[model samples]
Target: MSSANLDPLSRNLLIGVLALAGTLASFAATTAPIQAAQRGAYEVTLPRTLDASGRGIVSGTMWCSEGARCAAPANGERAVSLCGEVASQFGEVSRFAGPQGELGSDDLARCNAAVVRR
Candidate 1:
């Protein structure tokens, strides 16, 4: 079939898919270093209080220690709670808005949920 004969919606969908793939690739490339750095050492502190939305606010002072021995908290409710807290904090930051922000929220939730299972 001739390219010009394709429906506009189909063409748009094709373009959108390509765009999404490109974006994903670009993000992976850019995030590789940051991910590597995060792998080195990290910590997240849980807050005692929850926001109006019932989400925990992580204290800025709380941080992961740098070292190979440091490990994330064991999975279960604790992990889900931690992820919820991180997601909440990220939500509060306006800069994190959009697809990237959504991904961040999902990541936090998954991490927390995984912890609960552990």
Candidate 2:
């Protein structure tokens, strides 16, 4: 039945449903473009070498590139989320660790790669 011919209660319910849907559509439209425009990327390096027993050792540093193409949330918490996403691109976070032995002493080669912004 047409909304105009429906009871007051039914008419109000229909209107509310339509309004809620419209609000959701607007929200999606507004955010989709913003997310697409915000571009950012990061690179994580891992060093691998065989140990005395022939097991491989993995460790390295993470680097992020900055510029107009690289965009991340200005907010601290949200920015951290972006950083987490960047890190995930490489692999799990556990793969990254500090120098295994003595403090501030690592014998591995340094990572000098740059991140390309998305």
Query: What overall lDDT goes with each candidate model?
Result: 0.43, 0.37
lDDT, candidate 2, 39-66, per-residue tens = 3222222333212222111123233322
Q: What ranges in model 1 sit over 4 Å off?
A: 41-118
lDDT winner among the candidates? 1
RMSD (Cα, Å) of model 1: 16.2
TM-score for each candidate, following the candidate numbering: 0.31, 0.34
Model 1, 9-113: lDDT tens digits are: 988888899999999999999998776554442234332323333322253323232221112322223434444454444332111112112235555556455
Kindly give the number of clashing pairs for every candidate. Answer: 10, 1
- Stretches of candidate 2 exceeding 4 Å from the true structure: 40-118
Top of the candidates by TM-score: 2
* Residue 72 local lDDT, model 1: 35
